[model samples]
Target: MKLQSVAIFVLFLSLFVSVFSDTARTGDWTPIKNLNDPFVQEIAQILLKEHEKQSDEKLSLVAVVRGESQDGAGTNYRLVLEAKDESAATNIYEAIFWDKSFTHFKNLVSFKKTYLILLFYNII
Candidate 1:
């Protein structure tokens, strides 16, 4: 019975992965311990707090910029959040971005580290 249950669980997991394979590729996000930079930390805390207050759904802030970008200057930093789907992404954007408090997200990033936040959950 134990072995049979284990096999079933594995099969289910495999099927789940296969179903969302394409999304896994483009919107792949790595879970992490933390982002060490003080500025990024500040931004993340603000976003997380707002997300929690606005919705019951839990969301994660994954990477704060993709590709080969510089650490502090020149390159723009984009904050990527891993959403369940497009609707979640849209809601997050609407609830947070449209608010006046965080309206200057990109500018705030630039001010802190001369970077930009190309934030969007998973528009694709």
Candidate 2:
């Protein structure tokens, strides 16, 4: 009976660890292609095209999108802008922040910058 109880306790412990560990790992950065968001995918492509045009202080683009604690409406439109350096990121941030449409949609925006933009739209 003692051996059986020990086995059952071990099984429960393993299950608990697996569930919690998976949740804890969700915030980590994943590959840019893992976004799988059509809108974000389009934006990334457009940004990549523009990035190619820069000869100096260039921006190397990677479009990575991720949400917060849950897949709720909170952070669905999150996209991270990684650039060649801080200046590149800042420049990109400025372009997005000053765009007329986004300026009008400012109320719905979670935050905006050349380096990062989390629009109101849902990613999924």
Candidate 3:
């Protein structure tokens, strides 16, 4: 009877550990369900403004194509955006932004013209 109890306890402990580990893991990016959510649009706008400031390009955000976000010290957004300047055709860009709203801190991590844009240009 004692041996059976020990085995049962061990099984419960292992189960608990597996569940805890899954919950504790971080940095897994998950797709935003509502692409049209105002908050997601706001994040995309922020990325465009930051990119414009850094590059001195006057690009207006046409739309957010898609995005995923990861939770960490701040929320990290990976977005595919369509934007265009005054004289240029709409182009797709991929950008990453990290935001900590509680602290009012935000950073533009990276931005680059995506292959889709390059392929579009080549075909035209």
The best candidate by TM-score is 3
Q: Give the per-residue Cα lDDT of candidate 2 at 55.
A: 30
lDDT of 1: 0.41
lDDT for predicted candidate 3 compared with the true structure: 0.85
Q: Please, what is the TM-score per model?
A: 0.28, 0.31, 0.76
Q: Which ranges in model 3 have alpha carbons more than 4 Å from their true place?
A: 1-25, 116-124
User: Which window of ten consecutive residues has the lowest lDDT sum in model 3?
Assistant: 115-124
Which residue segments of model 2 deviate by more than 4 Å? 16-31, 34-39, 42-75, 81-90, 94-108, 114-124
Among the numbered candidates, top lDDT falls to 3
What's the lDDT for residue 79 in model 3?
Answer: 87
How many clashes would you count in candidate 2?
3
Predicted candidate 2 versus true structure: per-residue lDDT over 1-124, tens digit per residue: 9999999999999999988774435334323345556755555544444544543334555544442221222222334454444354432232221113433432122223432243432322
For each candidate, the alpha-carbon lDDT, in order, equals 0.41, 0.42, 0.85
Cα displacement (Å) at residue 96, model 2: 12
TM-score of 3: 0.76
- Writing each residue's lDDT as its tens digit, candidate 3 over 54-121 gives 99987888878778899989899998888898797888888999999999999999999887654643
Worst 10 residues of 2 by lDDT: 91-100
Error in Å for residue 89 of model 2: 12
